[model samples]
Target: MKLVIVDDEPLARDRLRRMVAEFPGYEVVAEAGNGDAAIRCVREQLADVILLDLHMPGLDGLQVARTLAELDVPPAVIFVTAHSEHALSAHNSHAAGYLLKPVRRDDLAAALARASRPSRAQVAALAGLDMADTPAYVSARTREGIERVAVGDILYFWADQKYTSVYHLSGELLIEQSLLALQQQLGSAFMRVHRKALVARRHIVGLRIDSRAGPLLSLRHCRCSIPVSRRRLAEVRALLEN
Candidate 1:
């Protein structure tokens, strides 16, 4: 199978490349350090499988998987992660299989075996999106390189002229996609808290309405006070009340 591997760590990429070479049926077609490069690789070269890493500098594996879900011929996914907490989530995402970090040969083979099988339509249905809609995952190029961060991980999105900055629990990432396009694609989980910002409901810590400052929304672990537009204040209040 033609395969692509994406991870941020150089050692991890090298190790996986070596391991993939050892596998008889699988051939490493491309290797990328971030999700953006991985997407470009997959688009340029038809891949049967993608060995995706869960965490990276710019984009995480889940975002890449979500983006691929919108493709007509999405490659089978085998998620590689160090954390055990993500295992259930991967299963929930209907990943072909998952391998723990410092992957063993046997584990790689097992994941490949799972990938070779037919995919369930139920898994596709769970993505909850049509292809025409803006993808839930956006590819961004950062100083560290290209990353694929999931829309769900994003605490908020802010527009900066030609660029859109995505703020997540990890950090901020800049993407070329327009903020308006992102707002439309982001589901109800994200709301327009301000004209310049779109905030994720899950990340919202508290809402404070000031007669002077107007309505303020705070994101968890985030220090910045996000302004809520007059039109969106009622909606924010209603959401918080519920």
Candidate 2:
């Protein structure tokens, strides 16, 4: 596997490079000091994975990841940051892994082992073939590492402050992407029932009138009800009837 290490600090990059050298079958194809250089190196070297630092001078790691996502064959990103706070943002950016500063060998090994390769859909999209409008899975960072929840299994998405909660068949997870972005990416499979919530059309059981909440959307396999705004109440009802 070819790897690109991106860190503003030369020492940090050297440490990562040395650690990576210890691992067999993986080579450091390139190294960069900033996000722009990182992007350039990845493209030039055709790197398979990137060890990225979050807090750089310009075009932070998150911005770089977003830009890379637009590429026909984007490389897997593994954020190597000191801040734990950006974990949700990293996962939302579809990062393959998140490692704190002073990265451990075991953690780096595990992350590389599970690093995402270009999906078949991505390959098809590059070939100008028909593909799904949205990604097949939404990822979340956990104690066990990155867990991917199938988009089809998602029941709803609720925006809570800075994070958007993804309610799927198994449970719930928080991602940093906004509702508007998700709505745009997910397309017709999800409906904007409220300003703060998006419900899966396939999981909609019905819309029920709530005495206090006015209107609430009931979803299959979900215990809690999602409040529907009065402005969108008619739309939700129409969705249910259809």
Candidate 3:
């Protein structure tokens, strides 16, 4: 797997680079001194996974994660931090896993193994959604490995130049596909609610007319309100009314 190491301390990056040498089939694609450099390296080098440090000068790990979340093909994040309190935040941010400072080779291997394994339920879930007639799985390449994800579990898909970002019930994953291709593969179960957004019909709970901003739709588990494009307002309303 193509991997990048991001840490403020040079020793930390060196240590991880040395330890990663023990793992077969894994190579250090790049190394960064801070979140900013890490983001640049991952984007330019197409890193599959990133071993990211939580604390740093300027942009921190969480900030890096948030920025990565916006990317079309985001690397699977494995946070390497000393603080346990940030564990909850890491999970909330949909990170693959975490490793403490002075990471053990065993722990790193285990995390990679978990990331590499296919979730059996993913296939079953796609079957249940009855989207087999269409291409419903997306290929997500992360720092640990590549994974196949069921599109049915995806809450929404957003276009990013040359790639698509998928937000699902369990977590977020990114794949290199145009929004047009994703919309085509997803078929009728998904609707293009806006020029850049496609939402799952199942995740749309209700539509609310925002007096100031016009119309909005509530997503099942997401707290933020999703805007209803003027052109799609009628369709969104009809979908909800039905």
Candidate 4:
């Protein structure tokens, strides 16, 4: 696979290039110092993957990834950053991998091996296009790697401190996104049942009044009921009635 290395520091770029050379079946097609240059290089080389730096002077990695997503066939992005805080943003950008600075050879190889060209639907989703009135998928970082859950399969999202928990048909995972951000991206299909939770409108079968918890939402496939705030109780009832 063709790869593009984008980093402002020449030494950092060199280190990545050397590590990439150790691996077979992959070649460094181009190198860029900044986000704009990286975009130009990717377009010219038609790179299959990009080892993108998170912090840059101009567009920044997130902006560049969003721009690349607008292309007809966008390459997979693997964010290489010193900071771990941007993992959530990288996930939102549809990154193929997330690597920390001072990258290890094994991690780099693993990331490259997993990297593949993203589909048009994925590209649209990365570009933040509401083509289907909601994002195609929601991503979470796991011990293995990045895990993506289809929006249709999601039951609800519960906010737990810094991370938001995703409950889906298959199982539950954690994503680094605010509940408000998820609600906006998910659109009308998800309702903010409480300050800490967002429930899928389609999965909401009924609302039961709990003696202890007050009002709780019953989901189609979910075993546990989601707590509904008193403020949003009227709205939830209206939605169920309709």
Candidate 5:
């Protein structure tokens, strides 16, 4: 299993690293000095589990866990902290395990063995992290690193060959998800213009009947005209008319 360690203290990180080395079949993919770096590591490494600390200078461990819970496939989290008093809060975060500071090798081993993915219910309980009430953002890989683009800002999602591309006014990025997944996760905010495309209804300006393409969708803040499939033409038209 892949693992990511997040802690601000170099000594604590080193200790955890050494303990993790004692176990087999576990690869330490990356280490972060703070929650921000940990979030980046989680996205880049696709870690199976995260060894998170409860308190840090910028984003605390709970904040990090809350952020991770919002992800499509959030990794399991095990909080390694001295504040056992926050156990209930950690439990609410749906943490796989909570290991107190001055962690023993045996305790760490037990937590590792019982690691489990946080359920959607657990994520929903995280205050100010719920996106179900409104549109949320998704993380996409970029040249610099992973970036979170608001679902509202997304002009469309186009499946070009192997991967899906997310387009926005700022730029476009190739994401590791099927177009269908985007349509389903994004809910009614997007309309399926084609099997390979999902265009944001907010960005869609108008629909036009094209002699060659059959139906075309005009989107705001975008130069290229989108092709609306025959099966979805009526739906797209109705949405635009509304």
Candidate 6:
């Protein structure tokens, strides 16, 4: 697997690179001396995993991991640090593994064996961020990584069997967050037209009645029409006419 080793210390980075090189099948794709550099390197290299050092000059390992989670395709992060006190934070961040400083070869291998994306709680803890902070943006999970979609850009939100798909001006992104939760968090900006869907209040240009499908809601920007349930038809029209 491809790996990026991030450390503020040159010697620490060198030691890690050398040690990782000794391990079979793990290629050292790029190295960064600090969080900013690490973010850039990971974005450029698209490495499979990152050996992240917790304490750094600007953004620490926790901060770096949280930011990286927003990427289109984020890599698995494993914290390698001297501090054992950060064990809880590391776990919350959904890090694949945590290795104490003076990392051993065996431990490194084991950590790599368990690499995975940072969990929602971990990322939130790292940044002291909340999922329902405001109505400006919402988080969506794409195949590659987590993405922040601007509220204005979002056309609608639809719930499928297992996932809630956020349809936006840019495109659609599947998110694990339930549509009800989205409606609650997004507040007045979005209004639900069906039990399974929430349409952007600002995006509704007109309402239509489909002969075959019944009621339909059209958007000024989106080509696709949203099905409006009978219960919500009057309310949808009220908002549209206003």
Candidate whose TM-score is highest: 2
Scored against the true structure, residue 200 in model 3 reaches a CA lDDT of 78
Candidate 1's TM-score: 0.49
Go through the candidates in order and give the C-alpha RMSD of each one to the true structure: 15.8, 15.8, 16.1, 15.0, 14.9, 13.3
Clashes of 5: 0
Q: Candidate 2: worst 10 consecutive residues by lDDT?
A: 120-129
lDDT of each residue in 11-117, candidate 4, tens digit only: 99999999999987689999999999999999999888999999989889999999998887688899999988998998887688999988988898878866843
For residue 188, give model 3's deviation from the true position in Å: 17
Model 3 bad stretches (over 4 Å) = 117-242
lDDT scores of the candidates, listed in order? 0.78, 0.84, 0.78, 0.87, 0.81, 0.82
Better of 3 and 5 by TM-score: 3
As a whole number from 0 to 100, the lDDT of residue 174 in candidate 2 is 86
Whole-model lDDT, candidate 4? 0.87
Which candidate leads in lDDT? 4
Instruction: Write down the TM-score of every candidate.
Output: 0.49, 0.52, 0.51, 0.50, 0.49, 0.48
Steric overlap count per candidate: 3, 0, 3, 0, 0, 5
lDDT of 2 by residue, 8-89 (tens): 9999999999999998868999999999999999999988799999999999999999988788878888999988999999
Model 3 C-alpha lDDT per residue in residues 192-238, reported as the tens digit of each score: 88877888776788888888977877887567777779999989888
RMSD of 5: 14.9
Q: Write the per-residue lDDT of candidate 1 for residues 78-180, one digit (tens) a residue.
A: 9998988999888888889899988999999888876854343322232344434535466788777888875545678888888888887568888877766
Task: Name the regions of candidate 2 deviating beyond 4 angstroms.
Answer: 123-129, 132-242
Q: At residue 223, what lDDT does model 2 achieve?
A: 84
Give candidate 6 misplaced runs (Cα > 4 Å).
116-242
- Model 1 residue runs over 4 Å out of place are 120-242
Give residue 25's error in model 4 in angstroms: 0.8
